[model samples]
Target: MASNVSDPAGARRPVIGLTTYLERATQGVWDVRASFLPQQYFDAVTASGGVAVLLPPQPAAQAAASVVLDGLDGLILTGGLDVQPELYGAARHPLTDPARADRDEWELALLAGARERGIPVFGICRGLQLINVAYGGTLHQHLPEALGTERYKIGGGVFAENTVDVDASTKLAGLIGAGPYGVHSYHHQGVDRLGEGLVVTARTDDGLVQAFEAPGDDYLVAVQWHPEENSADRRLFLGLVAAADAYAVSHRGVSA
Candidate 1:
């Protein structure tokens, strides 16, 4: 299993599974639906001292998710399309991306499996939204409409910047330190209602929930900003990787 794989430095690197995008992609003379994720995600995991594994959308089944997670010490729900509004009993907003039902279902299943197995999980952007919905929370659907500003998402591929204040007592605060911390932003929806058992760890000046985590000692952090975008500072990835390493140690004992 990947959790047992050692780096060239002879140190064990915990296996971390990262979810990817399922989209129509084109390269060279090929245009087809593809399961892919940004290289930055992979880089962050490895740079944080963990092995990265891309988990693309698969046939959504609890059994399948369980099987997949059995080999992983940590799980990351990467950023992507908006979660289906119907999951939270709301009509789809015009600004919401067309439902990527397959991805949603698969990722949701994976999340459930992660919870059942007590695997450390990190959610980024859409990953945050899905985690909220999975816990019976609702989304604002469109932040511009809800907040009446385009600040959260300045169009174009460029990412906007925002500062969020972290609660001084949360684990996130301990990891990233107290703030008013700057972060990369590019999302149209925000958490409208916090999910059950989820503790709000950070928020922006506009009162949008920017970071949260399920209540536990085991890592389960979710941030709305794109940490992978800023490779210069990988505190979030490092936190997850550290928790993953601990999990790997406890689960299977340190691999030789």
Candidate 2:
């Protein structure tokens, strides 16, 4: 296979598609029907030596998802709206946000195709929950109700600082730098049942499922916290970029 050298570093930057939220967004003057993604997600990808592409919900995820996957080296299932309880055969929790059916449909298609292709993938807060639901797992739906406290979700755009017990055997621990590192969290819904082929790699002081991965995959990570929320920590994003770079060598695409 031939390689494309379009980047300053003399190699094509890995194309990492980051899923977005379809929402009513406001800019300087007007509100618009937009596919919104936080700057942090983009910054993290770029800072880690990969190109970030925002992927929005389409009319038919099943039809377009494979085409989208064919053009990327990696995927980032980002954080956003709650996963509809019905997705995992559960009753709707009163506190859970109404389902974003379009996003659910689109992202799940992307995930299915990516998994089939062995594409590297990373999942953040809501992303983690979606991963669980994707693999026949369940979510707590509401941590406050289950734990009787809002420790996992301290609102006001605040990032809670908590320690996670990382398993030394997992890739997450090696990439996380130090042991028992404090992470930024913002969700209440957490992984309850272990997804098929998924193993726990990290946990919180309260024993919440903080991170997981597919054991034999080159790169497949899901975290209950938000690494993109804090730009300072580039470890997770760097890991994705590294995996994506390797993926590109095998699944070549146009230079980003």
| C-alpha root-mean-square deviation, each candidate | 1.4, 2.3
Query: How well is each residue in 1-256 modelled by candidate 2, as lDDT tens digits?
Result: 4222348657667788999987898889999999899899999998988888899999878989978887788899999879999999999988999989999999999999988888899999999999999999999989988778788889898988877888887889878853687788888799888788899999877778999998885689999888987778899999998888887776674434
lDDT of each: 0.89, 0.86
Stretches of candidate 1 above 4 Å error?
Answer: none
TM-score of 1: 0.96
lDDT of 1 by residue, 130-205 (tens): 9999999999998888999988889898899999999987889988997789999999999998999999999998
Q: Which candidate is the best by TM-score?
A: 1
lDDT of 2 at 29: 100
Q: What TM-score, computed on C-alpha atoms, does each candidate reach?
A: 0.96, 0.94
The Cα RMSD of model 1 versus the native structure comes to 1.4
Clashes of 1: 0
How accurate locally is residue 200 in candidate 1, as Cα lDDT from 0 to 100? Answer: 97
